[model samples]
Target: MSKHAGVVLPNKFDYGYHAEFQRQCSMCIDDATIEGIVFDFSRVEYLDSAALGMMLMWQRRAAAANKKMMIKGAKGATAQILAMANMQRIFEYI
Candidate 1:
């Protein structure tokens, strides 16, 4: 994850990435100049429940920091999964 570009999630956005994601978002909260985060799902083939939880965590953290969060490239099953989780209402899909 680049400090200025935000995180471009891995192809498998799963539990394995949780710890790192948390760390990155934590940094975002601390950096006053960081304006927002874009969670890129373009390469993600499978997004499991744990991934959803991670996103939710980031959402809360971003909100606390007064930053916006955007989800991009959610296709096919990935789109359905986010929809099922009702993440659309809380997050904007780009």
Candidate 2:
């Protein structure tokens, strides 16, 4: 089992990288070998609707694969945005 933790910005969260991340997560889930994913929002200053959509998509994927996705270290406006969007229900907030 493996664990990955970090904040992915839109610029770095391009389709290619996102796909790769998904693939990794899928593999982990399939094998029941991955512990989980922890997304740290300490440095995330901005997030577009697309990013939010991507997160929701990922949440679904994780659920289908029987894996867990968690968000942590969010503060300030970032936390507010997530709350406003009701992302807390989609992604486990820590």
Candidate 3:
């Protein structure tokens, strides 16, 4: 398995996407070889508070596993929302 794993987020990231996100997160987090996980928001045009909550949960899990967390391609409204939520403190933007 690769050292780095990532999930390309969908356009509408909300509660409905939780299962899929959890599935992918398990694959990445369970892999011992993985040192980092990236959340690619390039294609995500909108995200609700639920999505933010999910990300926070995952960030805590990742840290507990000694894995780094990164956020990629966040721009426009997505970027603004994240900034307002202060997500940058926990996730490195790549």
Candidate 4:
């Protein structure tokens, strides 16, 4: 089975929401046999350093598990943020 899962980042992804984000990611990763993760950022208006860090962490975890990690629906400011962080190269954006 392909372990493909997706998470829609809340409109506001900030420090306070870190734990929830982590929990969601972890749950998806742990529950799936395959390691494919797709983080849907279509709804996110702004992302801070913490969000970036969380993304990186999830990416690494997925990589370690030999899973494909991707980012989808990133546009506007969110797209710029990922681009600035050089995460565009690491994630597949759709």
Candidate 5:
């Protein structure tokens, strides 16, 4: 079975979510059964460059673990921001 994790992003994907984000990323990375992770951005309302940096970190971690990474439900400003950061080139959109 192909195991995957969907990490639901919070409303304010800022520095405040650092701990939680790290925990989530670690959870996924530590799980050897998890073959991929999809960052769900449907509920995110506000985000900053910090959030972008976090995403990059997650991507790197996932790569190092030999796992796939993806984005889901990124709309409005969230979508625009990801596009501006060229996240599409790194993460698959689901």
Candidate 6:
């Protein structure tokens, strides 16, 4: 069995694509029927300020829907970005 959730994010996230990413997250959150949301960062090589905002927005949306959120497979610069944002404290990283 897979631990990953159905909510999927893109391999690369930044300001230019924030709207699309937001839409995907909204679908998961507004559905309000998912057990959890997992952001698989294995392919995410770069992210930006908008990416941070997008994550925060998703976090809020998930909270509103009473869904747990998780992050996994963040490596290299992706890991550093998460650390720099201090997201490790707020999100469950596995």
The worst-scoring run of ten residues by lDDT in candidate 1 lies at: 1-10
Which candidate comes out best when scored by lDDT? 3
lDDT digits (tens) for residues 1-94 of candidate 5: 7889999999989999999999999999999999999899999988899999998998998999999999999899889989999999999999
Task: Residues 1-94, candidate 1: write the lDDT tens digits.
Answer: 3334367788888999988888887877788877777777888889899999888987897898788888888888888999999989988776
TM-score-based ranking, best first? 5, 3, 4, 1, 6, 2
Question: Candidate 5: deviation at residue 67, Å?
Answer: 0.5
TM values, all candidates:
0.87, 0.70, 0.96, 0.89, 0.96, 0.84
- Tell me the lDDT of candidate 4: 0.83
Worst 10 residues of 5 by lDDT: 53-62
After the best TM-score superposition of candidate 4, give how far the Cα of residue 12 lies from its true spot, in angstroms: 0.9
Model 2: per-residue lDDT, tens digit, 1-94?
4565444443333354566657655555566556566666776766666667777887787777766788887777778888999988778877
* Residue 68 displacement (Å), model 2: 1.0
Ten residues in sequence with the least summed lDDT for candidate 6: 1-10
Prediction-by-prediction clash tally:
0, 0, 0, 0, 0, 0
RMSD of each: 3.2, 3.5, 1.6, 1.5, 0.7, 2.4
List candidate 5 segments past 4 Å from native: none
Instruction: Determine the backbone clash count of candidate 6.
Output: 0
lDDT digits (tens) for residues 1-94 of candidate 6: 3333654456777887777777777776666456677887888888888888888888887887787778888899989999999998878887
Per-residue lDDT of candidate 3, residues 6-49 (tens digit): 89999999999999999999889999999999999999999999
Query: In candidate 1, which residue pairs get closer than 3 Å at backbone N, Cα or C atoms, i.e. clash?
Result: none
Tens digit per residue, CA lDDT, model 4, 44-77: 9988999888888888887876777888988899
- Each prediction's whole-model lDDT (CA): 0.82, 0.67, 0.94, 0.83, 0.93, 0.77
